[model samples]
Target: MPSIAPDGKPESPGKVEVQPVAKDNEIRKRIADILITTSWFGEPRVAVQEGIVFLKGTTENDEFKQWAGDLAKNTEGVVAVVNQIEVAPATIWDFDPTFQELNDLARGFVRLLPMIVVALIVITISWILARLTVYLLRRGLLARSLSHLLREVMARTGGMLVMLAGLYLVLRIAGLTQLALTVVGGTGLIGLVLGIAFREITENFLASLFLSLQQPFREGDLVEVAGVTGYVQRLTSRTTVLMTLDGNQVQVPNSTVFKSTIRNFTSNPNRRDDFIVGIGYDDSIPFAQEVALKVLAEHPAVLSEPEPLVLVESLGPSTVNLRVYFWLDGGQHSWLKVKSSVIRLVKRAFQDSGISLPDEAREVTFPHGVPVRMIEDEGAVESATAKPTAEPETVATKAEASLQSEAEEIKEQARRSWTPGENLLTLSSSTDDS
Candidate 1:
């Protein structure tokens, strides 16, 4: 029978017989022959014993050393590889790998050039859309009733949303979908932290928005709110400014102003004022009431339609206390001046009518007989007790000028010191008749 080769093909009669197992020398020679074909730091020595190959060499880098070891291990009949290959120390002139890495990076960037250009175009379009959104929002009906600050906030918010959408698309085009999601989520997280950190400021801002919408008080309107009584000057996002009665500026937080009760004095042109006047108990209450009413009725600033009232409030130890109530045009006259003038005229009228205002009576009981003292100044005593003989001079009774001038001055000062847009109220409310 003809001998068959390992491939199960019948061998030719002239072919030499082949051995099934390779010799150690043959394995070593095979690896050495392959090594000579490539460039290396130095020629290495290769040895094999019982099919185990041993390699020893020096190479310029670990990659070359690893390549030599792998070459030996893949050789025919190799059982194990003991690679004692050493990599040469780097020299200052060795920059081949670094240059190769840079070249590869440059090639990759060139490959992504088209994507980068598209991203830039997307960003530009997004920017234009953002600006257009802002313009449209500002001119929309939604902004008509909004305050300047609120309008700006809304417009900017709308624009930012557009820009964010553009950013997301750009990030996706750049193949950074995960990064885009992180950016969006991080923005919301940062906003939440800021809101919590500035809780009071956020509250004030929201309150200001509501106040601007509601318009509880307008600029130049006399108002009392948050324990402050003043003329409203301006309303900012954080605070509500007022010029107090003493002509001092006060800034109350919008949150406090919104939560507190607001008393608008200028809302109604007519206001009522009252004061207590005490007269001697022997004087007839009806006559004193008539005299006081006459004084208020005769005053030019006093409003007669409301009809002034004089009621017996209480009886004191030595006098009868009367409560006098009267109305006046608050828009044209200062209430302080009107009340002061009315008091003065009423006192004069009482004196002219002989309505005695007596002091509180005090009684003293002497355990011993009252000590008598002889008075040598009889003429002085008589003069002190004598009533005035001249006729009572007429007293002037009129409301002084209103505080509108002072408020205007304050408003002027605010205009000089602050921006006109800071004022969230219209001038119509200040100039309109109540």
Candidate 2:
């Protein structure tokens, strides 16, 4: 008979074998050996059927049970493995319960109860003091006419400082100094992150503070900010609110307001109104200016002290442009109404003086001498062909009368909605927006 090796292969012709070729029992034995060697998995019974391994046992934990099956599956000659192992249910011995443990926990709570109560009391006192301090500061600042925004900043900063002090004391009293330090350190990091994320908000807030301190335009002031002209309704930490002439609310960022040009119309009681009058090139320039100044001076709303100015500004294609400048009491009369009055009065004065205001003229030429027929208005025809002795009525007088009637109508309409009162500064109730 030929000798066989452990792997079931025939040995060399002259070699002697000490053990028969590996069999099912040997493979099973090898798997069992591996499982027993693993200390994490308590003894799991192993059986091999048709070169397949089945594990059956309970371990201290699922990890150990899983390890037993995995170990069998990895062994040589094991086609497959079925892990039927389960974890042993926890027993009372695991907790080793005793009244002493409960008694120790209760005693610990009792020992710390007094310190906890003291800490809470300290925090409460601190909060009350902080609020009182803020209230007092607000009253004092408001009395001093300090900006509302400045007052809020000072009060909040003071309150936060006081609160921080209180918190530190509480932590110390409760023997949490390490925790207090951790919180303090973390606060800086949190603030850094928030500052980076909300840079625009921070910039606007700072700009608002600067604006409040500078006092560029107060509430209710008519101002032109960044080309937006309106009445300042409110000033918040981030935005400046305006009630536009169109009756819409506009919120402009404080940063933009601070950076852009601000025209404060309400700052001055007097404002100048300017308009251009174009007269026919053939008209008298000096006569036109004289008539304009006279018309401006005669108007009740125009200021006499400054004296109205009329200068030949430029010569246009069809006329000589006269720029008329006049001063008015802006506080008493609406700028628009005053300007409209000036234009009407100037137009009438020019007509009465026979200084013709020019209009655009177009002359079209025919290429082959085409005959042209001119049509005139019926009113113009009646005026041209009327009797020379018909009261000698001047068209200027009729035009002036029509203008006066229209002015009275406008005045009546304005009176319906207008109330007599001086424009006062709008005071904001609070400024703690940031």
Candidate 3:
């Protein structure tokens, strides 16, 4: 209807033709053609009326129905989309059913229910049995006080793996291949990660196993490996910990322990210790050797199986050297104590025998000159009265001038080459951090 003018004259309404688009039907038809012909599924039942598309079809899923509707809606002049695609049931509905067929169907359902119940029963029973077995085994192993780390990993992983196997059996019985595949995929991914990320960790684990089997050293054993000599305190999966000589707890990688040379001082109950004893050149070499051997033979700890050797090894400038070898039982034998005991005994023996043990060599030489033997006692004698005539100075004065120069030089050298954290920074702490 046309709007009324201000003069009160009614205008005619504009044309409201609403002429239908002729091409709209053709576009919808084109879309229907595309869907039925181009798709993987053979054809779809389609209909259109008054520029509205009604999708009516049998399809595998809602996806195909919506797809058919969308295709038609995208056409030039489609006004609305109506989807009426019904999903086909997987089981065929045979209308003409025989009595035997009906009975068989009932039988199938009944058998399926019983089998499912049986499966649940078997799973529960097997699971209980497995748990009981694992618990028994774990308790027995734990009672023996096995390596803590190994025991923990073994117990946990053993029970878990057994449980996983049982679960897989249950899944298989229920015909859940998809679920089983998911589990397999996850396990494969975990194995891959372990293989790639924990390369060193795996090596360390194997090395730890090797260490346990080898019996090269054990707890409280004094061992030397890779220049870090210490007593074994504990062994973990990745590393062997040691109480170092300086009292620092040192954790060395099992990989390193395996790769390096391992000297186990405590493996054997008896350890042979040897040190060269120096006597004055004038002292009888034969008498000195006997006295040294006698000193070792008198010690209770000395092993009598292998007689200790006390023979002249070398002739020093001021003394006659004799190699004194002795064997002692026990890992706790102190090196300092053994040497001190032998030294004190040797000194007493020599004194009783009227033999003089040579003191340290006192060579008289200037800084730049060749070492010279002093005929006079003035320069060589260690006495207050006798001193170097070049200048009269106290011992402290001479020591300050000479030793201070050495101390400063040592400090300078230390400062120039001393980088304490160089190797420490180079070592990895990522595993420990983790």
lDDT of 2 by residue, 1-434 (tens): 33346864333333212245545677677766655665434566778888787887776666556556656665666678888877885566655346768888899999989888898899999999899888887877776445666778888888877888899889878788998888778778888898889999988888877877777877656789988987776677778877666655677888999999999877886889899989998888888888888887777778897988999999888889999999877666666767776787788788878999876665466888988666589898788778665222222234343222132233333334332222122333233221
lDDT of 1: 0.79
Each model's lDDT comes to 0.79, 0.72, 0.64
TM-score of 3: 0.49
Who is ahead in TM-score, 1 or 3? 1
CA deviation > 4 Å runs, candidate 1: 1-20, 29-44, 58-76, 79-83, 86-97, 141-146, 194-209, 236-239, 253-256, 279-299, 304-321, 348-356, 361-422, 426-434
* Per-residue alpha-carbon lDDT of candidate 1 for residues 1-434, written as tens digits (9 for 90 to 100): 22446864333323222256678877777677766666563768898999788888777777667767766666667789899988886688989889999999999999999999999999999999999999998889352655677777889899999999999999988989999999899889988999899999999998988997788887778899988998888888888988787867889999999999999988887899999999997898999999999998888888898999999999888889999999987777777887877888888889889999987554567999899866679898898779886533343333444323244565566556543336666533443433
Model 1 lowest lDDT segment of ten: 9-18
lDDT of model 1 at position 140: 90
Clashing residue pairs found in predicted model 3: 1-13, 2-12, 2-13
Compared with the true structure, what per-residue lDDT tens digits does model 3 show for residues 316-407? Answer: 77888888888766444455455556666766777778888765666566879776665566654656456445422222233233211122
lDDT of 1 at 115: 96
- Supply every candidate's count of residue pairs whose N, Cα or C atoms clash at under 3 angstroms: 0, 0, 3
Rank by TM-score, highest first: 1, 2, 3
